[model samples]
Target: MRWTKYWWLVMAVMLISTFAVFAVHDEAKGPEKFGRYEFKEQDKKAATDECDAGGKPGPEFVPTVRDKEPNLALLKDAKPEASSQLEGWCPRRHCVEYLNDGFYNNCRSWIIGAIPGWAQIDIGDVANVNRIYFGSDHSQGFLDRTTADFDILVATSKADPNSDANTWTKVYTHKGDPISETTEFTFKDVEARWLRLHIRTNGGARVDEIEIYGGKDPMDVEPSGKATTTWGEIKTE
Candidate 1:
């Protein structure tokens, strides 16, 4: 009887341990409703207020133009081109006229511009986007401040090359400091063909690069159970 009881206790302990491990994994993996684009809390509040006040969300609030333009201009004076270098990935870069003054061994660079100036890229076909990465060359430059003042937009139609103006659905806006390089946003059930990085003001700094990733078919991977501490790491799961 003693031997049987010990054996049962050992088995129970093992089962409990396994259950705990799985629980932790599931918690860390996060939620399944991860968004492709998300707005800052403050921005969300403002948007909500505007919406409640009978104001439309997105470009409706973005100023039509700026009083002054940034000294920097587009490098090629051409729009971004789609690249499939990363396999099922399309990446592009839009440079401001200004470059970093060789910070981070030239790793840190930026393009300064005014509000309403933006970089728009096609994600190819209407797909659900879930992740984004944004970085600046120099976090202290004039354009860095613009990140917070800007709003990211997405569109469901192919861009018209002949038209100077393109229409996109505004997704979210930044509310944190301008110097942050690695920022992430989450959007739920958003489908679009193009993504636009729209700045409300230059914040007197330049943007080094903005990356959009994650539109793959949903996977059944187990959750990691680790929670994100920063607002930038917003995950849908």
Candidate 2:
């Protein structure tokens, strides 16, 4: 048990280390008619005000005490996989609100792409994952049609998700009406160092938040109901 815990901790540290090199700054442009999508004017004050007014606890699914450090896909190293986002209202290191809380502040929301936009994380090594969470800002409009039709893929290397030059596997898929505030998707479990999310919106896919929560082994988890630990073992939090 001691050796196993030590290994898991070592792996965690190694994975977390890969993100230290990335740094992001948020900025964007004026709105104009682009394709089937519409961009509202840059109203930072209004957006901040809405967040202050009605933004609630987001993706409040798995309890923290139970699912502590829930999301393994390091946001610290996350970056836009497409032509980037709409500057200020984009994905990347800017969407921490969507990851931690799916607040509907009416103004501030995260928009991905206009058909095939993606957000990916380099886990550094093969990691175990089982569940994923996705959310979109409803303050602007309903996301039922905007958030569906997407593929969850994983590749050994950080390759272009939209191209055939890379070796990628579609681990999980989603196609539904994302009418609710937030939704959680579960799968058998996939082990990979990289997770690439490819979303297909008729024009633009606007999702407020996303989370990838999972674990590696049974011996390392304290599942809902379990037996007491054996004697002579010192447990660490």
The runs of at least 3 residues in candidate 1 whose Cα sits more than 4 Å from the true structure, single-residue gaps closed, are 1-110, 138-146, 158-166, 218-237
Name the best candidate (by lDDT).
Answer: 2
lDDT of each: 0.37, 0.45
Assess every candidate by TM-score. Answer: 0.42, 0.52
What digit string (tens of lDDT, one per residue) describes model 2 on residues 1-237? Answer: 999999999998876764432211122322232222222233444444444323332121222212443344323333324434545542322343343332332233455544566766554455566566555543323433356567667665556656334466676666765423445666655555566667765655655545555562311322232112111111111
Task: For residues 138-196, write the lDDT of model 1, one tens digit per residue.
Answer: 22212223355655566555564222345455556665555443355655435555666
What shift in Å separates residue 168 of candidate 1 from its native position after superposition? 1.9
Candidate maximizing TM-score:
2
Clashes of each: 30, 3
